[model samples]
Target: MRKRAKKHNYTVIIERIREMVRENGLQPGDRLPPERVLAAAFHVSRGSLRQALQALAERHIVESRQGQGTYLLADFDSVLPGDAILEKVSEHDNVLHDIFEFRRIIEPEIAALAAQRANVATLNQLKVLVYDQQRALFNNNEVDQFDTQFHQLLVAMTGNSVIAQVMQAIQAIVDTSRAPWLQSRKRRQMSIEGHLRIIDALEKKESDGARRAMQQHLAAVEQFIFDNQ
Candidate 1:
């Protein structure tokens, strides 16, 4: 029953809502602003806003509870773009190696920048993500999403829009690369330790230490992948 003409507008609106969520620090289970307020913020009609929310609900990105507002059910990339290409690349035999190499080259620098540029708010957000990662690991639950969020948050803290968008584009590939390794508790614990080290360095504003922590973390990931293969 949806109109084809509104599809493009709906997608744009969806991305805007995602941006709002990120900018506002709305985590999973966090309620969004009221419908009229959101519509006003986005400069769209209430009807159009409802349409976009409905689309997001369909993807399980947001859920509307009775007598309450819509809440985030998952992270931003829960519904990634370019699914066809993502699937093709993720299935490639060397994808994990490629992702590891890419992260090694980029993420240490991101950590270093985060050390230099992160304000208290940014550091606090990173801390929240680290604890989220730990909780996920302790529960023996899936950590791929939290793992991806941790890395993506690092990239975002760099205050570089280009880097953030580029990382976002390839996040699904990175998630695929991380999935197999996180299946082992030992590997997950190693990752958690590495993230803690990075956080410590960032909290102290030690650029070199942050960079070193990230490098060590990625090296461990590379070693794990090498041994498993």
Candidate 2:
């Protein structure tokens, strides 16, 4: 059908856009090429390009400003390759429990690694993300995207490709679940506070502190979700 074909085309366009980001070495907050330029380069109609952009926008991977061009909002590297781990697992499985347990086990080590490896630029970027999340909360906007960005950034700071791949799988699994849990302003504020503590530990390059902070944060998160559910 024509509709199916159009959908396929746009999906192709979206992957092409992701490839463009990789080829260009684009970073968070980097402005993408103008819409016209992108459409021309990809040999797609402007309408098709817009559809691709809209899909990215809904994922909070990118954002468009009124006068300014669209910009990358999160690291596209967080996208998993092929079918995600969750996709292969049974739907009736205790997937959420497995994910949280994995987080509690692995993420503390990630935080410690990040603390050992954090540089001035990485710290500055983390601060900016936290600030943006705070601003979003105050403005009554959803903070789940920022939350994702913050955690992804921490993973990036570790500079471990294997860890990156693992986090990407976890990200794919939780992408659908974040918004509902984050809808509560109290939850969002708590998340920000947890991020600050982790940031502080990273700034001091305290691996033990970072590990403890991450453990506490994950515990708090798991407890909150359990209480709510």
Candidate 3:
């Protein structure tokens, strides 16, 4: 009974920390409560309290920056969603498909521009992005932060700040979608393979090939989107 009670106590403490974070409107860069203070307030050992924080971090609700402190993650939930509307908002929506359409127009141009102007370092960065993504997908880390870097680096190669900004505006939706889209058996097998073809075209300075490869890749995205429709 004592052990069970202790478990319940820690769970309650974790919930309290979550509430405090929301109450303060904390963001990704915002520091969380210091360990000693929070543990003291909860009348719990630092070890148990850290475990609770770890749980929250895994859910992307918080983050810890080295030498700084634990931070409240900037995320969808930080938008001040009321509890009743939260679950409803998570369901699929058409906004993401629209973003994909936007990508269709922009991604090919970005690829073409990248072919025309990307320096050796930038082209190699694209290669690394594809390779790193392949590794992540194979390692089952595809749903992690690597997906963001993969797409972002692809666009970054174009050196178009405005295009990058447009992409960043819809970043959350794109990041959220990558896992479910990639989870399709077809993509799980060969998504990286297609991306590599694009990288190869870009590296070879083949503008037309890069354009075609990018178009084909995003065409896959379009098919995925409307297929769900």
Candidate 4:
């Protein structure tokens, strides 16, 4: 859970750095503040800030010089803007619908397979993920990370590399849509409850029950996202 939380913090810091780039009119090759300054300004530990910077470096968005400091490697405008979140959703309405439709068809089957094949270790991991989701709720943090992990873990449990690849393929758009869908506390709570029910079915090793639980969960989530949109 601490690991997940730290990962979340890194993500937050990375996004904030992007925002800072745009807000401050940072250009490619422009140097960012020193690590210490950035850490203080961002109200995060230097270690956490460094992790975030390392992530950006991995993405080729920024680079750290030897004893020089970090510098922007790309323009922030090339990245998706926060304001584009809903706009992208609205623009790709049909695509989004099809994605949800695909999930509805695929994820339940995955859940069913997981119920049959999941080992004790795998089940325990899923429980920890859902528990992390509960903790995120209490901490008023985003639950989507854990939610995504839980679903992906279920796919992995199915023991089909092809199915796992398929899930990974659609992950980007799924992530885009999920951000707005999960913005509401009610929706987040609903997601947690849905995951709990699916976990219960999996724990009992009831493939049929897991299938039903997953189908119901996806249906409700899809309805809410489309209805409220």
Residue-wise C-alpha lDDT for candidate 3, range 1-229, written one tens digit per residue: 1111112343556567757766777667778889898899878877557656654565566676788778777543554344422232222334445656666777787788878876888767767766676676667674335445656877887778998898888787666556442244355445566677777887788889988997888777556534432
Q: TM-scores across all candidates? A: 0.57, 0.58, 0.52, 0.60
In model 1, the Cα lDDT at residue 57 comes to 75
Runs in model 1 deviating more than 4 A are 1-93, 180-182
Q: Please give the distance, in angstroms, between residue 210's alpha carbon in candidate 2 and its true position after superposition.
A: 0.5
RMSD of each: 16.4, 14.8, 12.7, 10.1
Cα lDDT tens digits, model 4, 52-139, are: 6765675577899998999999875574446342233234455656777778788899999999998899999999998999999889
Residue pairs in steric clash, candidate 3? Answer: none
lDDT per residue (tens digit) for residues 1-229 in model 2: 1111112455677778888988999999899999999989999877657756765676677898989999998876575443232232223124555667677788899999999999999999999999999998999986778988998999999999999998797677765445452236666888899999999999999999999999998888766644443
User: Which parts of model 3 have CA positions greater than 4 angstroms off?
Assistant: 1-93, 179-182, 225-229
> Which residue pairs in model 2 clash with each other?
none
Which order, best to worst by TM-score? 4, 2, 1, 3
What lDDT score belongs to each candidate, Candidate 1 first?
0.75, 0.77, 0.64, 0.77
Candidate 4 segments exceeding 4 Å error: 1-90
Lowest-sum lDDT 10-residue window in model 3: 1-10
Q: Put down candidate 1 lDDT per residue, 14-85, tens digits, no spaces.
A: 768888988988898899999899888888866557756765675677898988988988876755553422
Candidate 2 local Cα displacement, residue 145, angstroms: 0.5
Q: How far off is model 4, as Cα RMSD?
A: 10.1
Consecutive 10-residue window with the lowest summed lDDT within model 1: 1-10
